[model samples]
Target: MKTVYGPYRSWRLGYALGVDPICRQPKVCNLKCVYCRLGCGGIMVTERGRFVDEDRVKEEAKEILDKEKVDVLEFRGTGEPFLAKNLHEIVRALRGLTDVPFGIVTNGTMLGRDDVRKELKDFDVIVVKLDAVDEDGFRRTNRPHHSITFERTLAAIRDTIAESKGDVIIQVMFYKGNVALADRISELVRDIGPSKVFLSTPQCPEIPGLSKKELTDLVELFSGMDVRTIYTECAKER
Candidate 1:
């Protein structure tokens, strides 16, 4: 894919025009989640660095905005967008050209980093991944690097929601292995108080998903919490 990918149908973000800020030779990310769309192979690194040309991203985004009509502009492509150092610059550059609402889909690992959180605070919508809460649960689902811990990531997510000037949507993926964490993750939703929560499962690897009835039951688990489950169907059709 080029610097930009899709105005693809986003079950959550509407028609999203995607911009890839991490366009290196091979995709690099922090976690190897069981449900990743990028397949089950890549470099897992936590180091923050510039991986793409900010000027190129700006040029592509401006060109797209001038040509197509999209419901939202998103910063997500090959890898963890937060790792891309030029993200803030790209967002500012695109903001100068169009008023389309911007959203970012990130793993939430870098939210504790002052620079990452500060740069991402101004987006219109931010999707923070919260697949698991505890260490074992995280290991089963997210399968993050040895350095990342559940407590730090959870705390950073809370901080991001508290400081974000826009909407925050907690994205959780449920599979057979991590299904037991439903209650714990719900408690997190109650604590973080995000505007919305998206519960989904992998479509690429075709993992077993919670049935519709099970999803309904899961929603009931968070009955009184100040959160809404946007996508109830776990096994979404491609």
Candidate 2:
């Protein structure tokens, strides 16, 4: 079986269907987080642009929403949705197709760019990956593209949320060795003050060598904060 994925319920947004906008051509993303489903292939430093059948992707989203009456339309799968360059246009088109709320999942490395933030500001929900709180942890877990600096990536996230005022949900996926400092994460969230800060781990074997207890512990830590935890695997049981 092909893992029988979604339309599964999301923690913060709602139900989602792990859709890939790029459609698996050839491209690179900013992060190489160990728990990611893309394996080791999709990590790249930089690229100009790529082609995706935007019309088809929109059609599929429409069909899925029409059939299921889902709560949110989330764009995340094989690779980063923001990398598609034409993501804004795709989201704009998706708005016309359904009343469902729209969202995008990204590594937050590109959000600092003016064009990227501009395109994203109109979205209903924006989930950013913040696995590391500082440069060292950022390097250790993310294994980001060489073109991206940790400072630049972090700054972009802060600036994007400051200007957009959209539902900016920051996700921190905890790992054992490559763990980010909790103080740093707390401080960053305090400063950025996104709509929510979601702490979770690889519930499925999207990436290997992760443990359930570690994720549970991270959630406990974040419970002290004012953010909401979007527990996909953990919440399903409840």
**Winning candidate number (TM-score):** 1
Per-residue lDDT of 82-123 in model 1, one digit per residue for the tens? 888778887877788778899988888888888886787658
lDDT of 2 by residue, 90-167 (tens): 777777877767787788887777677678865778888887777777787888777788899888887778777678
- Each candidate's number of clashing pairs is 0, 0
Question: Root-mean-square deviation of each candidate, in angstroms?
Answer: 2.6, 3.7
The C-alpha stretches of model 1 lying farther than 4 A from their native spots are: 224-238
lDDT values for all models: 0.78, 0.67
For candidate 2, the TM-score is 0.84
lDDT of 2: 0.67
